[model samples]
Target: MAHKNQFQLLASRRFLPFFLTQFLGAFNDNVFKSALMVMIAFRLAADQANALNNLAAGLFILPFFLFSATAGQLADKYDKAFLIRRIKLAEIGISLVGVVALISGSNTLCLAVLFLLGVQSAFFGPIKYAILPQHLRKTELVGGNALVEMATFVAILGGTIVGTILSGASDSGGGSEWIGGLIIAIAIVGYLVCRVIPDAAPPVPDLKIDLNPVRQTAHVLREVAKTPAIFYAIVGISWFWLLGAAYLTQIPSFGKNVLGGDEPLVALLLCSFTIGVAIGSLLCERLSGGRIELGLVPLGAAGLTYGGIALSVIGGNLAPLEEVSLAAFWGSPGAQMFLFHLALIGVFGGLYIVPLYAMIQERTAKALRARVIAVTNIMNSLFMVVSAVLGIVFLSLLDFSIPQFFMVIALMNAAVAIFVFSKVPEFAMRLLVWLLSHTMYRVRHEGLEQIPAEGPAIIACNHVSYVDALLLAGAVRRPIRFIMYKPIYEIPVLHFIFRTGRAIPICSRQKDPEGYARAFEEIEQGLKDGDLLCIFPEGQLTKDGEMQPFKAGIEKILQKTPVPVIPMALRGLWGSFFSHKDGHAFTTWPKRFWSSVSVVAGKPLDADTAKSDHLHQVVLGLRGERL
Candidate 1:
């Protein structure tokens, strides 16, 4: 069957209603929170209001730590659509509580309402994320997540604007009735929309509700730790939330203290971030072309770090200013630059998050997916809390300005990224592969499905360039451990990627007997472990545009672990950048920028027919006179 377009899901019964429901939920959360913040900033005591703001943020996040584990159990045990409806209806009741808080002007009651809604959001969190894999196709996950995140931040932008506006009006002798009415109205509409969401069959209808959040969290966390990759992904996702919470939670203070702007300018700062995130989110689908490409994580880290530090450096030395016209502010030498840096952070954030979410959905088993997501939520909440504490330490204790704290956050992102990448080298491998595919060369893959989707396989291809491994890695959806010469594997910049990718480094027995023996041992173990390992059967990169004789090492490796031999061919890499076609690679200019390249995988050769001579002819045929 032909696959349907992912965006089309938005128009169908599967996605649109769910999207609206979540968007509204996020919108409502922000609306009430922002309204309270506006009141505290504009009308309340300065010190007391600042303390309340911090407390408000903590109250909203506390429920996730307390309830996400239970929420995960419930999602797996019941109908998600029904659960959403109930949650939305609860939202209405809670907004009414907000009515009490708003009408009486009780900061205490408002905070209590915030905590209750946070509890509601905690329950809603697991189902919202876990439902996508239940409805959407695997290929559509990235696009779906992109759209969902885009709508979410945009809703945040909406809530910030609308809620602030209403609260502002309420403050002007309207007696808070205006804000109260609007919030309740929004809640009812959310419940109505959630009612239309399609139902997904519960994965474990008979799943016993584990009422103990602590025990349940521990058990689910054990399930999460069973898979190292998924656990690392959870950590990465949590760290992202930490960074986001740190930056976003400070927008109000950052604008006022650093940019010298008022509430209106704070709104503009958030709006820029939301718009930038939306743009970046939408760009994910086009960039990934429907797959969960983990490569973007590292790239996003780079942007996030760069943007944060740049903001810190640029925002220093600026004096506070009175509330001024935005037109005048935008004309200031530094305002737009600050916004640009903030926006850049959001853009990279979108790039970072969508892929990680899709990866979790794509890789995890259906049974444990929701529970795993819950663990991620719990960790995210914890990290956000840590971010808050860090903000206090840096600002109140260490006497750092908000802009200077941005630099500290940037360093935090870098440290976390390096730590996670060290734990899972696949991220590093994909980054190199993605960069090669996107920047210096455009790879057109052919006959990729001819290779087994998952299994032990040895791919033999002509190595036409120094980057042939990268091109092949980028071409195939699966990760491949390549066998390369030790010298090449140890190249200064490329070494880190090669080592992270677990590329088997070989040398002639005469050159290094121990290394050569270790290479074969590793290759045999990898194939036994059901890994895809790609090797240049010619044993080295072709000096000219022609296939070299297949190396005898392949025969030896296959003798030890005889897997299906997949023959691949690289065409149009000769004379291009990274190719030794004209002279030394990287020493010569690319024949042209963005040169076209193709990697073709032919049918897997049966063991009896997988002789070196026969497979050589097959690859040569696939190359088809490209030389």
Candidate 2:
């Protein structure tokens, strides 16, 4: 399957209506949130204003803790189209209440409506996420998620910009009355658009609603924990929220207190972050080849910390804390660096989140996905709350400055990333592949989709380098069980990864007859388990960058399994870093940096026609006589 740009998804009905509904919902969310924040910052006393701002943040998040579990059950129990329409209708009601509160100029009433809107959003979260797999084909999952992320962050930027501008209008907009009506209009439009979204059958139509949030939330999370990858993806995703909430929550204050600017500057910096996320989110599809490339998650975490630290120190005794015009701010030497840091942080955030989200969607059993998302939403809310608490503790109790707080978060981010990636080895595996494929060589994969997305198959390849297995693993979307010689599998550095990946390590029959017998049993069991099995038919790496005689082991395995065999070849790896160039690999310097390589996959062969000799020739032909 050839990958298409994310923008192509915009033309489809399966995506557009849901996209508009989600975008409008996010837009309305930020419009109200930004307006309230501005009021708390400007119209109230300093201490009370800070208190109210934090209160507003808590009010919006509390509903996620209270309602998300039940909402997940409801989404699973009902048609998503009907549920979304109802949620939008709830938004309209909430907006009506907001308008009344705005007219009355009552902060109490406004906060109440904020909570109600949060409740509406809590119900919408699971539906928005779980409905996608129902709408898009499997290959489109990553692109769909990337587009959704792009829309979300962009809407956030647009709404924040408009909300901040209107709050300063010195008219009814600034006073909140007109802005409330605007939110009402947006809510209605979202509802209308949601009407066009096709009905999505509920995953668990008989799901019983359990009203106890704490118990149900625990149950949902426990179910998700059954799949460690999905669970860790949720954790990684929540950690990202922690980073986001930290930056976004502190940005306005940081801008005013440290950067010597006011609320408008805060808006400007946030716009920069949002734009970066949009660009990064769209780029994720291209970078990952429309697959769940969790490798980028660690890269993103590292960039986030790096950018955070840069932003923290680079200001270097910036001008005094007072209002500065945009002209003066732009002219300042640190301005561009500061903006770059913020945008870089956001870009990495996009990279970290898009793949993790797609992975959760792709890996979870479809019937329970909504509940899993609900569990994720609950964790996200919890993480954001912790971020708020951390900020308060850092600033109020520790008496730390804003930049100092950032320094602490950045340091903590490194620790968190190490821990999370250690827990999920796949993330680290992909990271290795990404680093190798991107740094040492550029890998151009051909006919990758010929490898079936599911079922048992033999991935027979002519191995040329130590990294050949990794090359195939990275290029294919599915996880492949590699059969490697015991000596190579026991290489000190990669032994753990091979163990984690469940690579079948085989010893020669002459060396250990029993071990060799176990190897065949393992291979048969792997195929019986419907694994995608990869084998180097030569039984070892190429000594002269040429194909060795085909081993009989592959024929024995094929005779036992009788599965379709996919012929693949690794070209351009002959003189690469891991290749046996000039004697042993890594004994000398790499002859080339950023070398080019390719993995050519051929059409799957019928079980009846997949004789070992024929398969070897097929792989040679696909290798373009480079063999």
Candidate 3:
């Protein structure tokens, strides 16, 4: 049975083992990387340490660009469970080599181990996401992704803290042995946990492997481009990483130069951001009501902008202090605000990324999912590289203050978000619908599962308010093509959503025969194209919070394209802000916020039996005096 709470998945055999395996792998990677960074800082000259650190970062990221294509192919062509086991086994060997290098005090060998670990991670990345849809139900995708994201950030923080502590407690090379031991132990445990992961059969067992990275990368990019939604989702996801990298890379400097703080203050700032991201990520499942809610993406993106700007402002206004401890820094003016905005950035970031990941997995074809994810990985790597270079250009070359650089990033994020939302209005449309249903009304859905997951179906619902279509769009899992009245469809602001959503706008035959004919023609084509369509069979909103008689237009539709008709109803929307209870929608103040509302879907009826009067009664019964 699927768990209602995402946390409950931790107790399930299907998810727990796999989750642990990945968690351990991430933890181990960070522990090793952080320890190595600290060791270099302590033992080497400043310039040498800096150069090696940059090299380490680049080496770790290099594998994603070089091996992601082959990794994607391998993941699709083999059982994911088996591949995970072998990968974990390789990790064990790599950890042993790392131990030997640490014991010998060889930085060269240590860097080599880091590069090898990067290769291991690159191979694991494709399998990490591709296996999700195979193991999880559609309802659990958002929750699963939420948990993964939360675990990832938490693990990173924990590993960084632990590694720093371990290194700090030792002199010179003493911490190296402990780090090596911990890494090896984690790798072994990861292998053992992965052994229990349920089998995920290969999606394309006979697919040929493409060893040519350049050629395969081009191929996979082309494949992702075939689906504009998936491509844009990848782009959005990549942009998020770029934004995140900028914040993470600059935090230490922001603390030292901007806040005039020491290591403890840096740790505090990191904690604020990391914890915020964890909180935000966990909230995704709840805020989305356990669905892949794309609306959160825009909300997150906007929050990031606000948070970044807030941080920049706060940082710019701060008076400088010299080598202050965490406590001293906390006493600084604007310190609390800085931390809050940092956390806010993380929170919104969580809201932004989880849905995009779930959407990619849900939409991509199984045969090509891994390869597409590989392309995503490549994009992420490319973006991170660009982010690093931009950081240099902005701060180092241009002599811009960290606060100024942050403002640049925030404005850049805003621009990217606007461009993406314009190209993919579905994100913006969903955001509007989500806001309307979540803020203006407390929407409860009933029998929504009656709507087929994939098929051509007609939804005939009573129109109680002007915003009924938007409310229904928010409630339903599938994308819906609303057949809207022309005037309502042409309403400003709403018109963008309606048009972008591909709502078919119709007028009375006497008003505009051509438009009416065109609307029907579009409806026929939409159904033939296998879209889930919704029509307000009442033809217009009720004047007195009552159902209007269903129009014959639905019957005409069925005669031309006979498909299943699912009777649906909107209840308790009367006297609400969008309703006509007080003259007209938006003409008067809303009597209350979060008004109780319900959307009910009745069992499907064969098109032949779904007459106008019958659907009206069915909808009326479903509403059941709730208005």
Top lDDT hit: 3
- State the lDDT of candidate 3 residue by residue for 1-627, as single tens digits: 667889988888878998999999999888888888888888899999999999999999999999999999999999999999999999999999999987787889989999999999999999999999999998889888888988888888888888888877668447777888899999999999999999999989999998999999898788888767789999999998998889889998888776677778888889999889888988999998888899999999999999999989998998777547777677878889988999999999999999999999998999999999998999999999999999999999999999999999999999999988877777887898789768887789899999998879999999988888878888887889999899899999889878977899997899999999999999999999899999998788898988888889999999999999999988888998788997978899889888788999999999988999888888899999789
Candidate 2, residue 236: CA error in Å? 0.8
Lowest lDDT 10-mer window, candidate 3? 167-176
Off by over 4 Å in 2: 1-3, 40-48, 168-174, 321-323, 439-442, 446-458, 512-530, 554-567, 587-596, 601-618, 621-624
lDDT tens digits, residue span 1-627, model 2: 433777888888889999999999999998988887776677789999978987888899999999999988888889999999999998998899888877677889989988898998899999888998889887788889988988988887888878777776734444576688799999999999999999998888977789999999888778887767788889888988888888887887777777778767877888888878877887788888776787898898899899889978965445654438777777777888888888988888888899998888888887888888998999999999899889889999999888888888999999988888777767777888999877898888899989988888889999888888788888887888899988889987678778888899996899989999999999999999889999898888887877887787887887888898999998898877687867888787888878888899999998777777888888888887563
Q: Which ranking of candidates, highest TM-score first?
A: 3, 1, 2
Cα RMSDs of all predictions? 2.7, 3.1, 2.0
* lDDT-sorted candidate list, best first: 3, 2, 1
Q: lDDT by residue for model 1 over 1-627, one digit each (tens)?
A: 313555677886788889988998898898899888878777678898888887898899899989998999888888899899889989999999899998898988999999998999899989988999887877788888999989988987898788888888875677378778887888898888887888888888888888888898888778777766678988998898888888777887777766667778888888888888888887888787777888898888889889989988877745456546677678777777888988998999999989988888877777877888888899999998888889889998999888889899998889999999888877877888788778777778899989897889999898887777777776787778889988789888778877877899997899999989999999999998999998887877788788988878888887878899999999998888777866788897666767678889899997667788988999999999885
TM-score on alpha carbons, each prediction: 0.92, 0.90, 0.95
Give the lowest summed-lDDT range of ten residues in model 1: 1-10
Model 2 worst lDDT run, 10 consecutive residues: 314-323
Deviating ranges (above 4 Å) for candidate 3: 168-173
Between prediction 1 and prediction 3, the one with superior lDDT is 3
**Which prediction has more favorable lDDT, 1 or 2?**
2
For model 2 the local lDDT of residue 239 reads 85
